[model samples]
Target: MSDKMIHAYSGDEIDVHWDKRLCIHISECVQADDPLFEVGREPWCVPDEVAKAEVREVCERCPSGALSYVDKDGTPEQPASENTGQVVYNGPLYLSGELDIEGAPEDMPGVRFRAALCRCGASKNKPFCDNSHIAAGFEDFGAIGQSGPGLDPGSAASDGPLKIKAIPDGPLKMEGRLTLKAASGRSAWQGTKTALCRCGASKNKPFCDASHRAIGFKSD
Candidate 1:
């Protein structure tokens, strides 16, 4: 297991794990009425402060895949039934389903469910968003534009692994089925393969416009 992984809280029924490296501070865990996560507390996250169901709900809502939990007897966290990539307005790409992120660290112990990937080309953490888009003043309305040539209808009846390859100084090469959507929850694209922009210079927004080459964006 990764030394950086935080075993935040554990109890007879559940255990909470936090990956600091992946957190972008979306604040979902701290917004509940009872508030399982308190900023000033020594442990910060006290699963005992709330019910197991509430803890799991908040953790599942973490788009960055930073928070996860294990249950002793109840149903555990599972991968999404369908693969999806949701474009966040002026922010990262939120991906869910069975994901196989190329070069991602595998030492952390948790259920692999989701990830927030960089789109602004300014993240110190390449491929993963570190919320650098806000500082960089990256602006994208997160609207749907061109779509990939889709597969036969019902081809995606079952969830499959979505492979994301972060190309050096280029785009995120996605392989396997994906249902890409805009921030408004509208379908943007449906396909098995596509190259998404990491460089903020893409005129096509979510899709690569070869702007990485012109802007000399470096992923390393």
Candidate 2:
């Protein structure tokens, strides 16, 4: 999907905005207790149908940062206390924390707190996942890899923004504190920086093994 803004549902207590471009249709909102978010109805999102708190809760679960809610009181969604990345089962990398995605739109709410990044190297949307992995038949068990340097148990995990830079036709260059976890929620790697494979050809799984070059992956 192309980068663009969509409709906003304004309620008395909150305003819910949808960026359809980033949505991979995870269906978190559609499954909420309220009918505020439905798939086929016209004006699919009606924030007034749900409580303000529930709207925010549903929006936060959106991995693609496609949904966001603004409280009338001026309070914004806060980033997760700990920077973390989860390798989805044969899918994108889901990140939660203060995120600084290179070249991402600055005005998109919740974009800084959550993102679903393409790891299958087939997304026409580039850095963001567009559910292209499924059609491309990308397969990975999402297992924890060799342990990397981790922060001491007593040390505080950095509460700073994780900078993600998509290298030209290469891996995702991640900087800043982050704990990369497997699908089982087990820590696989922890560090301030790492290069993650996006070409779906790395023998080392998540980590880059220079396979993109070998496969002649074209990201542009």
lDDT values for all models: 0.84, 0.87
Candidate RMSDs in Å, in order, are: 2.3, 2.3
Q: How badly does each model clash, as a count of residue pairs?
A: 0, 0
Write the residue-wise lDDT of candidate 2 on 1-220 in tens digits: 3434566788899998888788998899899878888889878888888888888999898988989888999888999988899999999999999999889976666679999998999999888899999999999878866777765645454435789999999999988888989988887888877899999999887889999999999888
Candidate 2: residue pairs that collide: none
Q: After superposition, how far is residue 213 of candidate 1 from its true place, in Å?
A: 1.2
Question: In model 1, which regions exceed 4 Å deviation?
Answer: 1-7, 109-111, 151-159
Summarize candidate 1's per-residue lDDT along 1-220 as a digit string, tens digits.
5565555688567788888878899988787667688889878888887888888888888889889888878687888888899999999999988888988876443325789999999999888999999999999989987676875556763236888899999999998888999989998798888899999999987999899998889898
TM-scores for every predicted model = 0.90, 0.92
What shift in Å separates residue 206 of candidate 2 from its native position after superposition? Answer: 0.8
Clashes of 2: 0
